[model samples]
Target: MAAFEGAANPSEAIESGYYVHAPGKLLVDNISNRIALRPSSSHLLLGGIGSGKTTQLLVACQQINEIEDIHAIYVDVSRYTDISKITTGVLTAITGLELAKLIKDSQDKNVIESIKLIRNLAHGYTTEYDPYDDFYDDGGQYIAVKGIIPKKTEGYGISLQLVETVSKLAKATFENYGNLVLLFDGLDRLDDAKAFMQVVYSDAKSISSSGIGVVLIGSLTAIYGDYHDTVDKSLDYLCYQPFFDVENDPEAYNFFEEIIQTRSSEDFIEEAAIKALIRFSGGVLRDFITLTQASIEETYLSGEDKVQEQQVLKAVDSIGRNQLLGISDNELKIIKQILKTRIFIPRTDEDLRLLVRRVILEYRYPKLRYAVHPAIKPLIQQILD
Candidate 1:
């Protein structure tokens, strides 16, 4: 993990969603097309980790802020896995510039009182706040408060906190700025993708009617394949994966180049090596970077200072054994389910999709298929026994 400190190339920062370069243009294009007429559409930007989801989202936030007089918040699902953390993060993001900008002279008692009242609507506030009580349900639909969320010991109140914050920011921003947009990210990295989607689906109607625009980003595999598979469900019914029909729906090669192009060593990463890396990584951006990083370090340790195609292949092999491929008992079940469909043959790309779907469902399980996952051939046969 530490081997690729400088990251062997320039594009690593791009992979981590910092200094967004490649995907920023594409994402901004999508937003432009959306904002032309609708201005905002609740989109579930799906991609594997390091697939530029969060980077694209942050790009969206920064870009959208420039377009409309808006109130926006971003919910990071990693920490906000439970209800409490969710509420807190949502509320915190939603408060937006409202605290320091609007309400006027916040140092003054009246402004502080106003902020306190607003804060009460959020989870942690001890003061009394019930939307049904003093607030009128006149012009727009009266937003009902979800009730007070207790402070969490670990990850409990996060979700609640996030929603509360987003709601307040949306309402307040609309009152002052005339438009609001809230983005929820990191739903893919949660403990249960299905549960996260459940929260989203349950809230979708309300989110649509709330007079606030929202853009959600997560992995389609997590939302549709992984958690849903455990319950015996199909992906078609959930939030439509926008680019499902595109031939390279996963866009692995493009995504690899997308991240790689942004890094400092554009000239150093040879085209052949990039192709090999993409093919080896099965097109996931995260895998590409990890593999690249691994390969670069391997070359360095082997006395070569540059990235070579052969070095990339060795790196890919090492990455597979060291990281990309691992299978747990639960994941073995998923792999077995996929194997049931694939007939245990590495004949076609469709088979690869099934395998990838299962792999995506659970990284814990040994993901290396008999043909794809490098090495451990003797190891898996030994374990399966």
Candidate 2:
């Protein structure tokens, strides 16, 4: 049961012997070591969904927390706020919330006031001002007095206030805990590339200038086409976690095998079943875990003690069918073309969606290549034939 839990906490995964140390750890080490040397450095982690990005972020946080004179805070943005509505202000407020908790007992009046303001703003309460009071009645109409207009708490005002609040919190953290490094886990879920870029452009400088280290998980959109140049120039480093190249890398294949064997014994699942699960997983960790769990259920339903290749195949086919539920005929044609030719050149909105949905898997081993999800391969082949 524990073995097949797809998105286990990095610490829990490590403690329970479910964590696999492969090439992915290189990313964790790079971020951790850089933050240890310079606490104010900024880093961006780019990966697709189910690429173990959250796990990598948490592990790097754990490693950075161990370094002397450094403190790491892991913030799962999705856990605390709606990612669809995320903005620079919201991110600043949530980060302030975490910093406030770290220095809850601080007696600094400025820090305390900032904490109260952040709490109020996060709860949708803003400073009140009556614009109507500034208007004067002129016989037939209301006229605005030019010199006495009240300023509303929005736009530039809110941005300045939030920046000041985060600065104060960062100062307090340094005084109490030496240095602060924030590891953000959920910004990658933002579907709008422009919105994500806005956050990076608006807040990355402010946070770095305040002497706070940052490691943010970003979506693939940031690394594709036009957005890539801007993102590459904005951050101190950009680390990518691509799908494990199991087809060409023996070590990567062995890593998946160890992940499954750690959860269930060989006696419970046959070797061929494990191989089939790996092949159909498309080198994605989450898919591999899901397939393993489904195969276990298939065996249980059939009154069998050990999972066989047939059971694994049945589980994959069922999951594949579900994957195609909402796909349109046009999308099907696109997928069919990719499957038949085994080449994917991302050029349009539909291509990006397919990449995001994991219908198309990108691999960068001997050379960059794309392929259809192996679980759904047979069905597409049937349609073609």
Candidate 3:
């Protein structure tokens, strides 16, 4: 049987059959207006795992690139640095590599030489300098170099040096390409949401003032928590990438059906089975796709012509059991309480953790709502009983 596995990342999703238009277009329009009126703009794109935040960032980048007057530089921060242990020094090194790649590819002798000079001055830090011998090829693309910056550096001096280099590159890029926009993704992987906010709060002004627009992806907690106002004030816009509207929207169901058809026969999955999978996913795209994939396997193994209700239930039970195995007793208790009330207000790290782990799902359409993952409801009741 052909399985309906969803995209693992935005790039793959963009080239796949199930790609849909998200709210990122609004962000692109906002940035376009800002660019026409001002020298630079900085903003935030916030969402939970599988909420299509990365897809939104990719959409923004693709739309920005379509503009004749702007050159967009997309950087996946987690690729060059460790989010769990990132610090100012490490951030600088990673940011510098993205800047340096653009500069080197521009082939402007003056900018290239200036970067070399900055690299020499910043050589005292843990960031290494790999010259043309390693990065350049006949194809004329300046391939990026990847390495981690040592956590225990001599001092904070490296941060200053890296910042200076990035500023120079941003200025040069704008001079050559009319305008510049930096789209940063993968910072949400950081363990502490506050650190993600702190980094953006500290650097938003410099990046914007340098004539470089910024679109950063951050943790949902930092976007919706008490510090949300602070985040709102720090950037041009703090936008939330929403989950699917499965509960109240007919269009949502059609979208899921189309996704299944793209990878398999239209009749491969029963209509009742599809609805059950959607309800179980609670509108989280990743969970829905994953459960659908599991159901396909279960049906194929059972020699059924099409997926049935029993096979869908088996898939849901399997996923639910896996999720329950990962949480602590206290976390489970918090989730049980949320199930009892069908309400969740983020007040502590535990609350944030529950949302992050997908033990609790969030919905904004029709009204704000939170509930235990639908697939795990049976397991939760078992515990309570």
Candidate 4:
């Protein structure tokens, strides 16, 4: 079935009519319940690439808003600033600006003035409300505010000013909305592990101390291995979004089958064809949809009404070749070891990078397991041989 298209965020996924309420929904609800019970609780939600962290965050935001007296402010850090070099100042400013945009339509004059003050301080310009272009989902809710490098007369002192401005704005927001929840997504796009950690521990702590509930999206490396111990001490909750078990779980297989069925009729994909593609997908939702999309294109080119065994193989070959393009000799060595012994080296940057690239897939079943992506495994085996 051809209905599924990979979405970058949950809003788009829901709008696409392909969004499924998997266990991820329960995860969102649990986080919301925690925040509702303890208004000051903060959490870190972790998932690998293609694991749907952004979509989950959007769902969590919507769920949190449904709780009375709680206002949810979502700030996509990648949109407003360079996530790599994100400091306390940029993070706080971007957040304040989003809060301002959320309440700008209020009747309270003090709230409106405070929002204006936040916009001016953060953007060096006030956001002019235009009903035509500015209102009603012009791509994003907040105005795109670029990252500012404090030129001369800026540094720690400038950072202090940002913190103060954010504090003032937070006070106004709390006064207006009753309670505030910060949903920080897209932190996984940041390149530096150390920079991300610094923000999580130091900057995030300072902000949460002001009674604002926070839920941060983080990379797998930051949630597992050596960073795990460090993150454990810093967060109120560490929630892991795990991959599906395609090999043993019937429902997991059916979940993906339904995705295709939603897009096209059952007869459009043969039983063997869909199973083969899912085997190669390694249970990652994005990878599953992408491979299926390519297969559909190949079937169309071949003048076939339904995808069969041959189309799936060809699609895997194309995907495998693309994955093999830039893999290093050392990475090849690691892949070979995993293939031979079925043992994964402890978490390291190089290994984590492979997982990020989707060259490797990690699963949690009877126990933790790692495997080369099924699409690339045969290719890798042929190369190693």
lDDT of each: 0.48, 0.79, 0.71, 0.75
Question: In candidate 3, what are the lDDT values of residues 78-150, reduced to their tens digit?
Answer: 6754567564344445455566666686677867875775554433324434445655454443333323353
lDDT of 1 by residue, 56-91 (tens): 666667667677555455555444334424432332
Q: Candidate 2 has which clashing residue pairs, if any?
A: none
Query: Per-residue lDDT for 1-385 in model 2, tens only?
Result: 6668665665677777777777544789989998878888989998878888888887888899899999999888877756776765555666778888988887878878877766655554433344455443333343322110012322222267677777888887888788898888889889999878877766676677778888889998997745887786678989988888788888889989888878887678898998999999989888888888889899999999899999999999998988767777777899888866877898887888888888888887656888888988888778667
> In model 3, how large is the Cα lDDT of residue 380?
86
| Prediction-by-prediction clash tally | 33, 0, 0, 2
Superposed model 4: Cα runs more than 4 Å off: 7-9, 23-26, 105-113, 125-158, 224-226
Q: After superposition, how far is residue 192 of candidate 1 from its true place, in Å?
A: 2.7
Q: What is the lDDT of residue 371 in candidate 4?
A: 79
Q: How much is 184 displaced in model 1, in angstroms?
A: 1.5
Give the residue spans of candidate 2 off by over 4 A. 7-11, 126-158
Residue 224, candidate 1: C-alpha displacement in angstroms: 2.7
Cα TM-score per model: 0.60, 0.89, 0.83, 0.85
